[model samples]
Target: MSTTRTILICSGKGGVGKTTTTANLGIALARQGAKTVVLDADFGLRNLDLLLGLENRIVYTAQEVLAETCRLEQALVKHKQEPNLALLPAGNPRMLEWLKPKDMQAIVALLERQFDYVLIDCPAGIEDGFKNAAAAAREAVVITTPEVAAVRDADRVIGLLNTQGVQPVQLVLNRVRPKMMSNQEMLSVDDVTDILALPLLGLVFEDEQVIVSTNRGEPLTLSDSSSPAAQAYGNIAQRLQGEDIPLMDPSQARRGLRARMRKLMQTRIF
Candidate 1:
């Protein structure tokens, strides 16, 4: 077994596909044979379980574990098909008022002992929820879109993570539209990376299949679906495993975008 790693998947703003990234990444990691557990730190507004298609099997939640009503392991809902993956669902949202970061720290420590990777799906914004989610993570994956507001929020979160001493804070640029970039209506991968100035984990193109998969309660990376988003997610998972997979292009002009991101990854610069 490899050493355990706890990662917080968060964004400064909502609707940037943070939960989607966490769900797919967790499944992708599990598909690679890692014992992975995704914890929903969003409290009352839990959505990770739904994304993983395990919402119906949630017999217990993180709140129950914390309240001593159930053991931590008892609260875990195993993936129906992916044996190596499981979910720790969020409990009552009202619990957030009293939940502290140290409590999260303990839960993360316990989960790390049993899983190779603990992925925390953090709530949006820089509030108590974000602090509690980021508290236990040694590494953070900030999710953002190409819009100026999202990028600015991500930069703020990154700065906050730095202040919290989280090392190797990586960025996952999501919902990239290639055609818009070509028309100069959207920021290019280079534009986003230049402003963020962080190590690039991967980039996901805007794919309608992602929405379809989520609606079907399935992960995009579960099969060789050929969805550009699915392929991008697979590459991101491989990169997370420290593999040297080439960055993918999520646009109609696929090769160009891939080459640009590939060059950036190799050169460690924008």
Candidate 2:
């Protein structure tokens, strides 16, 4: 039997790629032979279904499951590209009036029985929606960007998670611009990690292909996606599966051979 693990993917603010991370991670996990289900826990403002390209196929939303109008299995929209992956999309905002933390927990408990991983795409902010998203999560992955405001908000969310007894809140830094970091205009990985003080999950640089893939409603973790963001998401999924993979360092990749050699020589023992 697969021991289901629930992970809530959250951000302190919006536009930090929280849903993007959840979508890609789900696809990656599915590719790795894990049965994964991603929930659009943003409730009234569902976009995960759109991201997974299953918007048209979503005949039954989570609201229907909560209302007992449909079974949970009926509400799951399986990925066309990945059979092992499924999505439980958010429901109507008006119908979500009766949705509570316990309701979320019950849904997660049912999902946990069947899949290896259940990733909840949490809504932005610290409102009731946040609590509902975090309620049944056994773990959390906080998403942030290389900006001051995002980092600060992430820190606040981490504190909230800690107080709520969410164990091992990992950090995934998204939209990292290495050029800005090198120019001292943006927060570096070290800077963000220092401030957040959370275990680093992964890093995704600012890649245009990510936006293109989002617009196309196909996650970049597809078999054909060669974008840097796609590889970062793959790495994160491996790490989540307890694989020891080094985080992507875009700055290192941009360095010239001479610069790399100089740094290597400066740090060499012999």
Candidate 3:
């Protein structure tokens, strides 16, 4: 089993695919035969379990274990296909604030023995909830889109991670539309990397399949097929394992008809 057991997925702002990235990365690692557990720390928002299609089966929660009402094993909700992957849901918002940080640390230490990787899906925003989510994590994955707002928030999160002594806060640039970047209308992968100044973990293209999968409560990394986003997530899992996997350049990823036309137009403009 790998010694580095916990990875926290965090972001300073909302609508930047933090939870989706968390869910799919768990899917990726588990498929590789790692014993993985995705812990939703989203508090009130609580969408991680839904994204995995395990909402109805969540009888026990992290709160239950904290309250000493159930064993952590009893609280684990197993994934349908992957026996190696499990989920420990964050309880509802109203009661989450009451969960002490010491209890959380104790639980994480206990869980580290049972799994190879423990991914904590942190809530958006840097509040008490975010502090609790990142408290015991040694490593982190900070996800953001190519938008300026998301990029800016990611920088702030990176700064906070450093302040907390969290080393190697990796970045994932998601939903990057290639055409707009060439036209100089949107933030490119380079633009985001330059601004955030963190080690690049993965870059996921704007994919229609991502939306469809999310709406259906299915994570993108489950199937064998490789969409732009799915492949990026898979690569991220390998990177987390300390493997050197080359990232797919976002511009190189979108090689469809639309991107071809946009590339031609840009060449003509120059």
Top candidate on TM-score is 2
Query: What lDDT does the true structure give each of the candidates?
Result: 0.87, 0.89, 0.84
Evaluated with lDDT, which candidate comes out highest?
Answer: 2
Tens-digit lDDT string for candidate 2 (75-186): 9989998999999976665676667889888888888888999999999999899998888888999999988889988899999999989997999999888788888898
Ranking by lDDT: 2, 1, 3
lDDT string for model 1 (47-118, tens) is 887888887888877767878999987898898888899898656666667678887887888798899999
Candidate 1: stretches off by over 4 Å: 250-270
lDDT tens per residue, model 3, 145-257: 88988888888988888998887788888888888877779987787889888888887888899888988878889997578788888998998888999888655654888
Question: Considering summed lDDT, which 10 consecutive residues are worst modelled in model 3?
Answer: 96-105
Candidate 2: regions farther than 4 A off? 256-270
Off by over 4 Å in 3: 257-270
**TM-score to native of every candidate shown:** 0.91, 0.92, 0.91
Relative to the true structure, candidate 1 reaches a TM of 0.91
